[model samples]
Target: MFGMRKWNTPVLRPTAPFIIGGIAVFYLVAKAQDAMINSEEYKNDPRNPAIASGKKAH
Candidate 1:
């Protein structure tokens, strides 16, 4: 067993650029969700209960 090879796995590292990109991605996703919740089709969708009270789902 000692002569056999072992699994080689890469370490997880979060660099500065990756972190900044992640933050930007999160911001864009949040903005996209906001736009979706404010869309007319979403507001009129039967599955959305908040629209019945004239309020967006947020």
Candidate 2:
């Protein structure tokens, strides 16, 4: 003898979009970081100058 409930359905089966969206976001972030590390733009950025001397501006 088995007892089954008629109202025992899952309420979260519509989360496929959110799960796929999260994976896509993570992939984009990783790709961007890889590009930055391998690109010339990161090496030529002036905000992070290699010179240790501070310049005085008028």
Candidate 3:
């Protein structure tokens, strides 16, 4: 059958919706990582006193 022959191809095109969704997820994860790395709350935590004091010598 013609339909069966089409299915036998080794390469298949990705659908637009799935591609868009993957890009959105990747963007969101990158933004979250950036926010975490640059957050002031994370840098000034009392539990890590050394990090807070290290920035003051400059």
Candidate 4:
């Protein structure tokens, strides 16, 4: 009589969490940048005299 044995394997790599965390961080940064760019405060800042004088260059 011949018998076969099966082996169970476990995941040894710990890269999934790091990849997911990096993606989440990237999304958050992009979202924050978009919000800042679209905000009125950023568009109407006094530091840039051009914007305050209503002479935005295209």
Could you say which candidate leads in lDDT? 1
| lDDT on C-alpha atoms for all candidate structures | 0.74, 0.62, 0.63, 0.68
- Stretches of candidate 3 off by over 4 Å are 1-14, 44-58
Residue by residue across 1-58, what tens digits does model 2's lDDT show? Answer: 3588777766556887888899999999999875664467654454533322343211
In model 2, the runs with Cα more than 4 Å from the true position are: 1-5, 9-12, 43-58
Give the distance in Å from residue 44's predicted Cα in candidate 1 to where it truly belongs. 3.0
Between 2 and 4, whose TM-score is larger?
Answer: 4
Highest TM-score: which candidate? 1
RMSD of every prediction: 5.9, 9.8, 6.4, 9.4
- lDDT per residue, candidate 1, 1-58, as tens digits? 6765688544445376788898999999999886886787886677665677668454
User: After aligning candidate 1 to the native by TM-score, how far in Å is the CA of 30 from where it should be?
Assistant: 0.6
Candidate 3's TM-score: 0.48
Q: Ten residues in a row with the worst lDDT in model 1?
A: 8-17
User: Once superposed on the true structure, which residue ranges of model 1 sit more than 4 Å away at CA?
Assistant: 1-14, 49-58
Range of the 10 consecutive residues with the lowest summed lDDT in candidate 2:
49-58
Q: lDDT tens string, model 3, 1-58?
A: 4445645654336476777889999999999875664577665555544455565321
Which pairs in model 4 have colliding backbones?
none
